[model samples]
Target: GEAGRAAALEGLERKVKAAMRSTTLNRLAPDLEALVRAETIAVQAGPRPSADESVLAEIRGAVLAGRPLSFIYSRPGAEARSRSVAPCGVMFGRANYLVAADRESGRIQTFRLDRMTSVEAGDGLATPPADFDLAAFASQSFGIYQDEIEDVVLRVTPQGATEARGWRWHPTQTLEDQPDGSVVVRFRASGMRELAWHLFSWGEQVTIEAPQRLKAVMAGELAAAGRALSRAQS
Candidate 1:
């Protein structure tokens, strides 16, 4: 199984290298020229989020040039507003986000690429803080949206311990085997809403032991589901 996965990764890497050689991709990411020429393997799961190619090109160019960006960002149920930020980096997961710092507040924020309009690069140069590490910043959250970080603990029943042991929950997660044959999973992260969404799939196999916020979020989801089922029955 491990060998098959390795082969698949290698094949994907070859395909990516081939794709990066295209005129369009090369133009969009000239900084990646050296990277594409190097040997590397990368594999990702889940559906890739889609965004405007022109918007992505603009962001990439700004990031490469260490320039600030101006755009109009709109969130659901909120009025669109203009924003100016120094481009830090872009993170691609189930959704693509521009992780940038607010020009006025100097506070870091994430804006979905799909939600941005009228994207323009600023004239003045800007860059991330000297101590800023993209990987470290990304690891602070369970998902893309960052909030208050909390110590999360999950207890997996004996029936699910085997599966849990093999799963990588988070980069900072540690697994502890219990005398009762169960497993305790612990990590520090944010994005309780996303965590609650994932825990729904586990049914009763997993139980949250800390972070009242996550427990409350899970309860709220359960109550909402109950209400929806009641409405359906009527």
Candidate 2:
């Protein structure tokens, strides 16, 4: 009985993993699609960012074949340059990125798919490090951009405490209720600039409690806004 139960659990786990990997709406059953359409509405305000489908296909093939990739990449405000990297996987978020490692230096990096051109897979075999984990690598940053990680601490005022408690700020985040009806949220992450941008909307309800870098970035953003407002008034 125990062995039979274990086998059934393993089969169910495999099916769950397979379902999680199937992302497109077209993969949903007709009834499920109708239910989703009736219950959900996405309010995208602008054109959704996308990568070249052909380039994505080329990179996906290279990753699956354990081959290296060569492409010309153009970073923002920079000239285009040639690159050779070992494809690890693709991360789809606000934008699509190729998570890869330099063939020569072995340094892992993320390249935006939209900025890539003339993508070609190499004949030589290349693969991610045996211990490389795509999800763990992506989680190191608050958003897409990666930098030095820090212990981030925030204090949400009583007015926003309930909302903050219900929010999923980060995968590693933990919230603690304060005696004064406030809440303290703590998490370790990078991408301070992006975090600063998000904190702007919280107004006075959120207070930065640690990591001087985030505080400085928030202050800089506030000063820039102040200058823009003054110019508009003048």
Candidate 3:
């Protein structure tokens, strides 16, 4: 999918360059060529081909057409299951996700696109609920895992403020610069375990300021990790 999008962008760039070359007078050619070269290079960020392009296309077309879709899904430690869903929207980021309404539960669900073994159009078209907001749904979680949502607050030390200011923790994150040169970032999010794992990267630079549950989870994670290390050494 990325490859296709890149190719399309490249093709349009070529057309624009050809038109500019043919229409501009000789006096303006050098300036126009220089601008074109700069933009062309800027647009050439690396993108790769999708592993399951056809399956993605099937679900994408269904979502666009307000149609339902059926797919065979599988993941580690789980039985391969078949599902029918009312396609709502598709989200692409670090990994692609299919945001849809489950036919049985009638609740919105997110599916990893790569986990889908096969996808096809279902019989009747089903329009997504008017109240559904794909962006809001995805932002409900700190990471992809869906869990109890909590108000998360982190206090970054003065030493980590510069780097923390540049880091985006969530779509709804709020960063406040303290008078002491430290920074406090707050965001309401789900996936506590995932958040704890991410905070490990910040190490001693960050402290959990709110949500006692988050601090507990972080301690549990460290304890479990220590036990694992001990077992491995034994």
RMSD of each: 9.4, 9.1, 4.5
Task: Sort the candidates on lDDT, descending order.
Answer: 1, 2, 3
Model 1 superposed RMSD (Cα): 9.4
Model 2, residue pairs in steric clash: none
Clashing pairs in 1: none
Of the two candidates 1 and 3, the one with more favorable lDDT, higher being better, is: 1
The estimated TM-scores of all candidates read 0.78, 0.80, 0.79
lDDT of 3: 0.83
Q: What is the Cα-based TM-score of model 3?
A: 0.79
lDDT over C-alpha atoms for residue 49 of model 2: 49
lDDT tens digits by residue: candidate 1, 100-150: 987766777899887899999889987877787889999989999889999
Model 2 global lDDT (CA atoms, 0 to 1) = 0.87
Which stretches of model 2 miss by more than 4 angstroms? 1-37, 45-47, 228-234
lDDT tens digits, residues 161-234, model 3? 99999998998899999999999999999889889988998999999988999999999999999999999999
